[model samples]
Each structure stands twice: as structure tokens, then as C-alpha cells.
Target chain A: MVDVQAHLPVLIVTVPLIGGILTIATGRGWKPWAWATFLTGTVFYFTIRLMMQVLASKTGMVSYELGNWPRQWGIEYRVDALNAFILLIVGGVGFITTIYAKLSVEKEIPADRVNFFYAVWVLAITGLLGITVTGDAFNVYVLLEISSLTVYALIAMGKDMHRGALTASLRYLILGSVGASFILLGIGYLMMITGTLNMQDMHDRLMSVPGILESRTVLVAFAFLLAGLGMKMAMFPLHMWLPRAYTYAPSAVSALLAATATKVGVYMAFRFLFTIFGVGFSFGMMPSGLVLLLCASAGILVTGVTAIRQTNLKRMLAYSSVGQLGYIVLGFALANLHGIAGSVAHIFNHAVMKGGMFMALGAVVYRTGRCDIRSVRGLGKQMPLTLAAFTVGGLGLIGFPLTAGFISKWYLVQGCLERPGGWPLAAVVLIGSLLAVVYTWRVVEAAYFQEPDPGTPPVEEAPLMMLIPMWTLIGASIYFGINATFTGHIALTAARSLLGGAP
Target chain B: MTGVLGIYNYWIYVILMMIGLYGVIAKPNLIKQAIALGLFQTGIFLYYISMAVIDGGTAPVWTTVQDGAQKFQGPYDNPLPHVLILTAIVVSVSVLAVALALIINIKRRYGTIEADEIEAMDIADRLAEFHAGAAADAVDEAAAEGHGLEHAHGGHHHG
Candidate 1:
């Protein structure tokens, strides 16, 4: 057990990676799905074990150097509270989505391509998990590409449903490549100055280099990194590629991408902002805090209003994701303890709420073959359980009391109130919630009140496979909502460590 | 003046990146955009390679020192960026392949590789759906609040 424990960091990533390539050989029918489900389940177990080890470790961190080489010369796998929390989220969501994918995949994707689909599916999860676990700066870029490339293929697989999937995938490829290249440029600039790729070593070297914060190259690098990561996370103005990509992808792919993709992007942003740059240089010596705050505030209002206008339910949820991510960015940009804690908590909360909501839509698509507003008409009585799951998930999105979202908004509001001259931000959060209500209400009214058109065929309820995983996440969101001790404590601990306080 | 000219490769990098950016944004053809993305990636590759250079430096290979020498004569260029860019180039090629495959699929489906034409087709499809849904919305007026407002104006304006 001790020997296995020591290799947990690398095992968590490589297990899925090798298993994904192996999945392509599983051939046709339920075999590929079963193999992927088992692989993701094992990965999820490893992530849980790794998280337990992180909590048990004295420093609240674990680091492993690859190939038994010195840290500065080789790649590293570092796991701390922040990333351990993210890894558990990606793992849990990946497993649930894989379970949900079997039915959706058999329906949406062609038969011969199903095995390859599962291969890319597991590979995508491997890339996301790898991004969250690695400690080397350049490795992040490589893994980012891995995830991005696999996602492009996954999104394109939706072409059978709508030909628009091709355009969406292509647009994402172009913009994602540019964004990643910007990050590569930024990292190259950093390496020129610090001469090291290990994140912790980079930080140490940056600190010792006098006035390096003011250097033009460093400033340019910061700008590029922020812009690139912002685009990746779908921050406000840079979110042009997101709505259509989510809307046109297959139901299972939508749930996985919505739940894990941008959240991992936010994790990468945190590593760059807090770990490598340090809080003082990032917030004090630079103007990033104010800039991020302003952009996030505007994004919250704009995307919230835009979400209300979407004709397609998936596109609406996609827009709402941008707004939700704005709240997370807003939380951290405030740079206070409560604010950063709120940011950390919302990452977990939003993943569950959004992932569950997307799964609910996937079920609707499974039943009716489309997720347009008109398709869900009178679904309340027909698919009661599915619509109810969607309604509760929607309520969570609106941050209704006794739901997981309220806990995040409650902390966010407290953070805003704690900072002087922060009442406007607090109002923005409330207003954003109101906008959520408007969009969620539109769907509920359509499903519950309106009559199904007589011309269309009657639809059945979603399969048991879909319902089980949908409620698992919805159930988690609510359970964590009422009992905030676990999430709140870890979030606070993560916030403290990010601010240079003792773990 | 010399300080600015000393990093002339950066100037070339900037130029290549701008040209690629312009092509991606301005060109309406999907194939052109894909090619432009490749150019943009090439510019970044050059940036990494230029950073690896050292004046009068040799390759980053170790050589045994002669008997008279206390240390190996060195001034080797940084090879790490070269190695990093090699991985990046592989990623770049994969992206190009995916983009081309997607473009071919688009052409097969829509019978056009022009982005503008494809977008026009998508817009027309959405408009058709909107009009069909609007006819039904007349039965339930209250439900026509959000998506209907914009598309309603579009219908009348287009008519």
C-alpha cells in the first residue's frame, strides 16, 4: 500500500491515458462503453485515494519528480488541496458522465465510430485530470492541447445531429489553437527569464530577481497568459466559441465539457495567478485584480441577460455558464479571504449544478430528439422526474435558498461586503441571480404550462441509466448545500494557502 | 536604435503573427482560415526558436574536454525550447489535420467550404424553425416573451 501510495500521482493520470488507447480495441456494441465505465471508475477511485493522501500529508501537499531526476531538471506531479479538490471533481463528473454516455452515445453516434468515441472520451478525461495534477508549467500546455484536441473530435461527432456541429468544432479549433499559442508564448517568455519550468522553482527564482515584476517581458507574458486563459475559460468578451460548441455537441459530450472543461481552465488560471506569480506580484505590483473584477462584473450582467434570449435550451445553459464562471472570477479577483473562498466553493458547486442541468437536457434530447424551447412543451406531465430534476437544478442555478448555489452566492456576497466600496458588486450578484430566475422560469413555464403540439409524436421518459446519474449530481448539489461544513472548510483552507497563510 | 534592431527576429515574428491573424479574421473561406491558423502557430514556433539562440554558440551537445583544458569550452544554445517546440509542432500538425477533416465534412454536408455561405445556411435554418414555432406561439402569447422578440423583428424586417 505504501509503495502504491507513492505512485498515486502519476497513476491517476496514466491509468486513464493507457486505458483510453486500449478502449479503441473493445470493438462494437456495449463493450466499449463498459470498458470506459470501468476505466473511469478506477480513475475516480485513484483520485479519491490521492485526495485522502493530500489531506493526510503534513504539508497539505504532495510532490513527485518524474524518472527519479532532480526537480529542476525533470517534470513534476504536484497535488495540493486546491488541485486535489479539482481532481476529485473532474474524476467524479467524468465517471458519472461516462455512465450517462452509453445510452446517449448509442443513439446519437453511428455504430462503427462508438469505440473511437469512447477512446477519445477517456482521453479527454485523462487530459483534464492531467492538467489539474501536473506541476510543470510546460506540461500544462501539452496537456491543454491534448484535452482541446480530443474535445474538438468529440464536438465534431455531433455532426449527425446538426451539421452546425462541424462549424462549431472548427471555430473552436481555430480560436483554441490561437489561445493555446498565446499561452505557449507566455511560458516561453517566463522560461527565458527564470531558466526553469517547475512551477515552484519558477516562483522562487521570480521572487529573488529584483524588480522582475516591472520588466516589460514579464508584463507582456502576464498579459498573454491572462488573455489566453481568459479565452479558454470563456471569460466575458472572449467567450465567442462556447455557446455554439456546447449547443451543437452530443448530449453526453455537452455534459462532460460543460462540467469539467472550463472548470479546469479556471484551475490553470489559479496556478498561474496564485502559485507561480505570488499574490503580491499578481495583485499588488500588477493591475490584474481590478481588470478582472471589472470584466467579470460586466460579464455577469451581460451573459445573464443574453442567456434569457436563447431559443435553444442548450445554448441558454451555455450562456448561463459564462455568467456563472464570471461569479467565480469575481470571487477570486476580490483577493480577500472570503472572496477567494467563495471562488473555490463555487467551482465545486457550479460543476455539480451545471453538470446536472446539462445531463437533464441530455435526457430531454434523448426523449424528444431536440432541446428547443418548443420541444419541452408539456413535458412536465410526460417526463415528470426528468423535468423535476431540471427544475431543481435550475433553482440551484438561481441560488435559491437550501440549494448548493446559495452557499456560493452567500459567501460571494459576504466577500463583496467585506471589502470597502464593494456594495455594487454585491448588487451585481443579486441581479445576476434575478436574471437566472428569468431564464429558468421561461423553461419551467414552457414545460409545465404549455400544451404539446398535436402534430408531433408523443415522447417517453428518459432511460433509467440517464436518470440515475442525473440525480446523483443533483442530489450531491443539495446535500452539500444544506451541510456546508465540508465544502466551506476546505474552500477556506484553500483560500488561506493561496493568500500565503499557513495551510 | 541598435537595441531595437538587435531583436529583429521578434519583428519578423510579430509580422507573421499579424498576417496570420488578419487571414483568420478577414478570409471567408474555411480552408484559408485553417491555413492561417498554421501560420500563426509557425510564428510562435519561431518565437521559441529565436529565444533559444546565443551569439556564436554551438549545438547543445556535451563534448569531452582536452587534457589542457580545465572545463569543456562551452556557450551552447538553450536546447529546451527546441525540444518544447518540437512537441508543439506535433500538436500543431494534429490540429491542422482535424481542421481539414472538419472542413471536408462541412463541404460534404453543406456543399460549400465558404464560412459566410455556411453561416447564411444556418441562419436560414434557424429562421425557418422560428417561423414555424411563431405560428404555434400565437396560441400561447405569454410564452413569446424572450426568443420571440428578436426573431419576430427579423421576420418582419426580412419580409
Candidate 2:
């Protein structure tokens, strides 16, 4: 057990990587699904174990160098309180979505391609986990490309359903490649100055080097990294590719990407800003905080209103995702204890909420074969459980009391009140919630009040397979919302460690 | 002037990258966008490869002395960046492949790879879907109000 514990990080990534490629030989039908489920389940178990080990370790950190080589020359896999929390979120969501995906994939994708689909699916999850676990900055870029390529393929798979999916995927590929190149350029600049790719070593070198922090090269690197990550995370004005991609992708893909992809982008931002750059250089010497704060605030308002205007429910939630990400960015940009903690907590909370909501939408598509506002009219009678889950998830999005979103928002508001001239940001949060109410209410009213179309065929509730996973996520959100001790504790621990507090 | 001339490769890379970016943004053809993306990545690859160069450096291959006591050498070009760019080149090729595949799919589906034409087609599809949904709502309203009119959209199938 001790030996296995030491090798957990690399094993967690490699198992899925090998397993995903091997899934292609699984052939068709339920074979690939079963293989994927086992792989994801194993990964999820490893994540939980790693999280416990991180807590149990002396320094709240664990480092494993490849092939027993020295740290400077070899790649390392580092796990700390911060990334352990993120790994748990990604792993847990991947496992749950894999279970939900079997039914949804069959309904959506063609049979011959199902095996390849699952292969790419697991590969994408592997890339996400790999990026979260690696210590080398160059490794981050490689894994990022792995994930982006797989995601582009995944979104393009939706072309059979709608031709627009083709365009959406192409647009994303072009933009995503540009963003990735910018990141590559940034890393090149950093390597030129520091002569290292290890993140912690880079930080130390930056500190000891004379006047390097003020240099034009380092500044350019910072700008490029920030812009690239912003585009990846769909920050405000850079979020154009998101709505259509989510709207057109296969349902399970949407749930997986919505829950995990952008959250990982935020995680990368945290690493670059807090871990490598240090809070002093990032927030003090640089004007990034003020810049991020403004973008996040404007994103919250603009995306919230735009979410209300979307005719399709999936598109609406996609826009809401952009808006919710704003709160997370705002929380971290504040650079205060409560603010960063709130950011961390919301990562978990919003994952559960939005993951559950997207799963519910998938179920709606499964049953009635449509997801527009009109198809759900009078769906309350036909699919009470699914719509109820959506309604509750929407309430969580509005930060209603006794919901997980409320806990994060409460911390965020307290964080705002902690700073002078933060009240305006607080008001923006409130107004954003109000806009959420309007959009969510649109769905609830359509489902509950209006009559079902007499012309369309009658529908039933979603299959048991789909409902179970959807409710599991929704139930976890509510459970964590009421008893915030676990999430709050982990989030605060991660936040404190990020701010250079005692580990 | 010497300082600027010293880094001529970087200047060329910048020019190539901007031109590629311009094509991606300004061109309306899907295939052109894919080609432009490749050009843009090639510029970045050039940046990485050029930065790895030293004034009078040799290949990174090491040669050992007969006694193995003087096995070290000075002024070898950095191999790490070249290795890194090799992986990046693979990534770029895969991206180009995917982009071309998607372009082929767009051509198959819409019969045109022009960006504006695809946008127009998508908008028209959405408009038709909106009308169908609205027409369904009208039928529902008519039924609820006990109106005699039953068929909406003149017998067009709703679902």
C-alpha cells in the first residue's frame, strides 16, 4: 500500500491513457462503455486516495520525479492541497459523466463510431487529469493540446445532428490553436530567462534574478499566458466559441466539457498567478488583478443578460456558464482570503450544479427528442423528476439559500465587503443572480404552466440509467450546500496555501 | 541597427505570424482558415527553433575523450527547445488534419465552405425552427381557447 501510494500520481494518469487507447479494440455496443466506466472508476478511486494522502502528508504536498532523475532535468508530478481539490472535482465528474454517457451516446452517435468515441472521451479526461497533475510547465502545454484536439473531435461529432456543429468545431480549433501558440510563446520567453521549465524552480529563479520581474520579456510572457488562458476559459469577450460548441455537441460531451474544461482553465490561471508568479509579482507589480476584475464584472453582466435572451435552453445554460465563471475569476482577482476561498468553493459547487443541469437537459432530449423552451412546455407532468432537478439546479445557480451556490456567493459577498469600493462588485453579483432568476424562470414556467403540444407524440420520463446519475449530482450539490464543512474546509485550505500561508 | 539585425529570424517570424493571423481573420473560406492556422503555428515553431541557436554551436551529440576525463564541451546549441518543438510540430499536424476533416464535412453538408454562406444557412435553419416552435404554440393556444382551427403551418409536420 505504501509503495502504491508513492506511485499514485503517474499511475492515475497512465492507466487512463493506456486504457483509452485500448478501448478502441473493445468493438461496439456496450463493450466500450463498460471499459470506459471501469477506467474512470479506477481514476476516481485514485483521485480520492491521492487527496487523502495529500492531507496526511507532512508538507501537504507530494512530488514524484520521473525515472528517479533529479528534479531540474526530469519531469515531475506534484500534488498539493490546491490541485488535489481540483483533481477530485475532475475525477468525480468524469466518473459520473461516464456512467451517464452510455445511454446518451447510444442515442446520439452512430454505432460503428461508438468505440472511437469512448476512446477519445477517456483520452480527453486523461488529458485534463494530466494537466492538473504535472509539475512541468511545458508538460502543461502538451496535455492542453491533447485535450483541445480531442475536444475538437468530440464537438465535430455532433455534425450528424446539425451542420452548424462543423462550423463551431472549426472556429474553436482555429481560435484554440492561436491561444495555445501564445502559451507556447510565453513558455519560450520564460525558459529563455530562467533556463528551466519546472514551475517552482522558475518562481525561485525569478525571485533571485536581478530586476527580472520588471523586464519586458517577463511582462510579455505574463500577458500572453493570461490572454491565452482567458481565451481557453472563455473569459467574457473571448467566449464566442463556447455557446455554439456546447449547444451542438453530443449531450454527454457538453456535460463533461462544461463541468471540467473551463474549471481547469481557471486552475491553470491560479497556478500561473499564485504559484509560479507569486501573489506579490502577479497582483502587486502587475496590473492584472484590476484588469481581470473589470473583465469578470463586465462578463457577469453581459453574459447574464445574454443568457436570458437565448431561445434554446442548452445555449442559455452555456451562456450562464460564462457568467458563472466570472464569479470565480472575480473571487480570485480580489486576492483576499475569503475571496480566493470563495473562488475555490465555487469551482466545486458550480461543477456539481452545472453538471447536474446539463445532464438533466440531456435527459430531456432523450425523452421528448427536443430541448427548446417550447418542447419542455407541460413537461412537468411527463418528466417531473428531470424538470425538478433542472429547477432545483437553476435555483442553485441563482444562489438561493440552502443551495450550494448560495454558500459560495455568501463567501464572495463577504469577500467583497472586506475591501473598500467593493460594494459595486457586490451589486453586480446580485444583479447577475437576478438575471439568472429570469432565465431559469423562463424554463420553469414553460415546463410547468404551458400546455404540451397536442400534435407531437407523447413522451415518458427519462430512463432510469440517466435519472440516477443526474439526481446523484443534484443531491450532492444540495448535500454540500447545507453542510459546507467539508467543501469549505478543503477550499479554505487550498486558498490559504495559494496565498503563501502555512501549508 | 545592429541590435535589430542581430535577431532577423525573430522579425521574420513576427511578420509570418501576423500575416497568417490576418488570413485566418480576413479570409472567408474555411480551407483558407485551416492553411492560415498552419502558417501561424509554423511561425511559432520557427520562433522556438531560432531561439535554440547559439552563434557557433554544434549539434547536441556528445563525444567522450579516450580517458573519459574531458567529456564535457562548451557552446552547444540547446536541444531541449528543438525537442519541444518536435512535439509541437506533431500537435500542429494533428490540428491541421482535424481542421481539414472538419472543412470536408462542412463542404459535404452545406455544399459550400464559405464562412458567410454557412452563417446564412445556419440562420435560416434557426429561423425555420423558430417558426415551427411558434406555430406549435399557436396550435396549443387555439386548442385551449376552443377555436375550430386545428392545423397550423398548413399541415406541416411540427416535430
Candidate 3:
């Protein structure tokens, strides 16, 4: 029984994987089956949390070798403070998104397509969870492709905006596949040099190979991995597919991907740079820190500036998502305990903020049948609760004090200032926050200040089904902000582990 | 430099990768872009396969007649990259198939597969709609401003 319990993390992913296949086999008449599968995923999420607590208490890490194989010889699934924290985020967001999807799917998706959507949703979640939990380097790329492919399908299924969604999904598919290829190539190169695919083994092997630290091949692999993961994470220049995909996707799909998908990619990047490659090999040996810093700084300014000009609420949020990712990257590039902690905290913080905001927007769309800023005028008076959730979420985006966003930005700025000549970087980070305020305030202004058209019909509040989860996430954003000790402790410990110390 | 042919093979993979990347970046058509993505993935596959090849490697499968003794030597091919590439190929094909399906749907709805043209159409529609809204607002403002004077004159005549 203890051994069985030890497999809970893997079970969390595998249950969904098997459920997806079963869902497809049952076809369209299996709504109850779909719900059951989704519920199972929710159960798995809770179990995963329990397992995380146990791991945190016991050995301070969880490692499971697949097929009863030894770690170095076969695939390994390892969860530590770093990944377990991310696993919680992915699973928690995934559970809520699944519940939200149950109601939203019935409205937006055709009856015939609902089953397929649920199947793909489960598969995507499974892939994301796998990516987060797996300790094997190549497995990340495989799981990434699985999630990316399903995401393309899910996005392409949007109602009348099929053209835009299809185009966006295609663009993502092309770019995403190429990115995965680069990752695969980079992993191949790493394996060629290290003779192992296990991340810890690769790290250990990499240390002893003479001149391996200075190998151009290693640098090339690093570049490939960075570019590949950057595209998936929607880092600024590679963010072309983001706006349209987010705007046109079924709102629930948008929420899930915004909350969890790209965050997984970010986690992968962190894992590669900080753990597998090791910080000293990457930051101390190469110019990676500078490269990441430059890209992140540019991403923050460019994407934040661009966000303010978007008229569509979803598009604006998408741009904000890009800017937020830049902040996370910047935190990682700072290359310190504070920096890594801030980045990790932001991972959780941004998810709640973006997820809540998107869910609120989805609620507005549900009530009013439009996502345009003009359409949401006077929504604050009508859908007061949903709009209030949006306000809290928006404030979080602006890094207002007592919101989760502020805590992340505080640490990130502190991280930046820890280095010499870091004040300018800190200023840029502050400017990014100000830009977030501008765009978020734009929505608030439109929602509250603009009067409703006299002839328009009155709208009701979003259904309680949707409002419940939206408020739950909003509450989490505030709750985490106030009692950040729990999250902060995990983040700090995770950062230490990532920086090569055992928790 | 002593092994001249090995260097040439590496360059071929590099050229292939660049070609695929160029096509993906330069092409505007969705289908063409998907093909380009496939080519890029194939380039990686080529690189991996080439890396796996030894001087005189045979196929990886073993025969019972050979007493299951593996022929692992300098002349044997490294099976790892081949295996990895096979999985990569499958993933690439899956992505391609989905991308192509999306393209078909795009063509069905928008009547064009050109990304630029579709974007142009969307922008033009938005601009036209924006102009119409501005025109409506102008008329509404003019009507509101005149209605005050009409109301004032009617009230005075009635008094």
C-alpha cells in the first residue's frame, strides 16, 4: 500500500492519459463518462497535493523510476519542491478549469464536439502534468508535443471564429513543432555528450567531461533549447500566435492554457538552466544570463506597451500574459536566490491572476455574447460580482500591494538590485508594472465609466456555476498574497534546490 | 580535419535545417508553413540519424541464429538516435496532420490560405466598422445639441 501510494504522482498523470483514451472510445454519447474522467482528474489533483505534502515532510523529494527500472537506465519521474510546487499549480488550475469547462462547453461548443473537446482537454492536462513531473530531459519534449498538438485542436474548434482560430492554431502548430524539434535536437546533443537522458545523470556526467563546459556544441544546444522553450512560453518576439489563439479559443480553453500550459514551458526552461545544465555551467560559464536578461527586458517593455493598444479584452490579456512571462524570465536571469524565488512565486501568482481575469472575462462574454471592450460597458453595474473579480485580478496584474503580483514583483526587483548596475533593470521592471496598470485601468474605465447604450437590453449576472470558480481564484489571489508564508517557503526552498542544494 | 567526409555530412544537416527554417519564416501560406515545419523537423531527424551512424554499422535487430550476441563495436550503428528520431517523426506527423486539418477549416471559412490576405481582410472590416461608428456618433451628437434649442423654443411658445 505504501508503494502504491508512492506512485500517486505518476498516477495523477496516467489516470488522465488512460481516461482520455477511454473518452475517445466511448464517443459522443458519453457525457457522464466524460464528467467521470474529469472528476477522476480532480481526485488525482488532490491526491497529488497529499503526495507533495508527504514528500516535503519525508525525504524532501519524490523520485519514481518507471517500469521498476533504475533511474539511470530508464525513465524517471522526480518531484521536488520545484516541480511539486508547479504540479500543484497545474493540477489546481486544471481542476477548476475542468469544472468551468463542463458548463462553458455546453454553451460554446456544439453538442457533437463536446466529447472530443473533453478528451483533448484531459490529454492536454496529462501532458502538462507529465512535463512538470518527469525528470527525464527528453520526456519533456515528448510531453510538450502532446500538449501542443491537443491545444491546436482545441483552439481550432472555436465557433464562428473558426477561421481566426484555425489560422492562429496553425501558426502555433508550425512554430511549436519547430520549437519541439529544436528541443529534441538539443536533448540529442546533450545525450551525445553525456551518454545519459536522466537529468541528474546528465548533470553529473556533464561536470567531468574535459572541455565539455566550453564546448560550442553545448552552447548550441543551450541556444536551441532556449529558443524552443521561448516560443512555447510565448516570449515576446515569438508571441505572434498568442493573441488570436487566446481571443478566438473557447473561453475555457483560453483560461486553461493561459493558466497552465505556458507555465509548464517556463518550468521546463528553469529546470534545464538551473538543474540539468546547472547554474554555474550556464550562468558562470556562458553569456546566457546576459542573453536572457536582454530578451526579458525587451519583452517586458515591448509587450507591455503593445498591450495597452488592444481593444479586445482577451487580446489585451494575451499581451499582458506575454509581458508577465517576460517578468518571470527576468527573475530567472537575475541568477540569485531571490531571483529564482521571485520567478517561482510569479509562476503561481501569474496563473491565478490571469486565470481569474480570463474566467471573469469569460463570464462577461457568457452574459453579453461579446468580448469587445465596448460591449462590456456598464458591466460593473450588472455583473457586479464578476466585475469585482476582474478588478481584484486586474489589481493583481498591476502588482498592487497585498495582491500576489506585488509579492512577486517585490522579490524580482530585489533580485535585480542584488547585482551591480542593477538599478536600471529594476526601473525597467517597475515601468512594466506601470504599463500593466495602464492597460488594466483601460478595461476598468470601459467597464465602469462608459454608460450603457439606452436601447440595449439589460443583462444578468454570469451564472453561479462560473462565478463560483472565478471568485474562488480571486480569493486565492488575495489569500496567497496575505499569507504568503506557505507559498514563499516553498518557493525559497525550491529555488535552493534548483540552485544545486538539496532541500 | 583528418576525417573529411564526417565534416561534410554535418554541413549537409546544417544546410537542411537552415532551409527548413527559412521556409517556415518566409512563407505566408499556412499549408506551406506546415510543410516547412515538417522539413525543419526532418532536418533534426537527419542530424540525429547521421550522429547514430558508425563507420560500418548494420541494422539494430538481432537474429536468433546469431545466438543473441549483440554486434556492438565501432562499426555498429548507434541505435539510440534512430529510435529517438523515429518518435520525433511520429510527433511531427501528428502535428502536421492537425495543422493541415486546421488549414482546411481556414480555407473553408475565409476562402484563403494566405495569412497576410486574411489579416488584411480582417483589418479592412474593422476599419470600415470603426468609420461607421464614428459617423453614427457624430450624427447623434449633432441631433442632441439641436434638440435642446427646439425644446426651449417650444416651451417659450407654449408659455
User: Can you list each candidate's DockQ?
Assistant: 0.34, 0.42, 0.26
Q: Write the per-residue lDDT of candidate 1 for residues A1-503, one digit (tens) a residue.
A: 45878998998888899999999999999999999999999999999999999999999999988888888899999998999999999999999999999999988999999999999999999999999999999999999999999999999999888777889999999999999988998898888889999888888888888988788888888899999999999888899999999998999999999999999999888899888888897888889999999999999999999999988899999999999999999999998989999999999999999999999999998887668898899999889889998999999989998889999999999999998999999999999999999999999999999988655567788889999999999999999999999899889888998888222
**DockQ-based ranking, best first?**
2, 1, 3
Give the whole-model CA lDDT for all candidates, comma-separated.
Answer: 0.90, 0.89, 0.80
Off-target runs (Cα >4 Å) in candidate 3 are A1-3, A25-40, A43-47, A50-58, A501-503, B64-75, B125-159
Quote the TM-score that chain A achieves in each candidate.
0.98, 0.98, 0.96
Q: Candidate order by TM-score, highest to lowest?
A: 2, 1, 3
Per-residue C-alpha lDDT of model 2 across residues A53-105, encoded as one tens digit per residue: 99999888999998887879989899998889899999999999999999998
Give the TM-score (vs. native) of candidate 2.
0.95
Candidate 2 to native Cα RMSD, angstroms: 3.3
How far off is residue B65 in model 1, in Å?
8.7
DockQ of 3: 0.26
B1-159, model 3: which lDDT tens digit per residue? 447674676788888888888988898887778787878878788888888776667776644555776654335687877777778889988988887888887787778989899778666645643443333333454442345323422221110
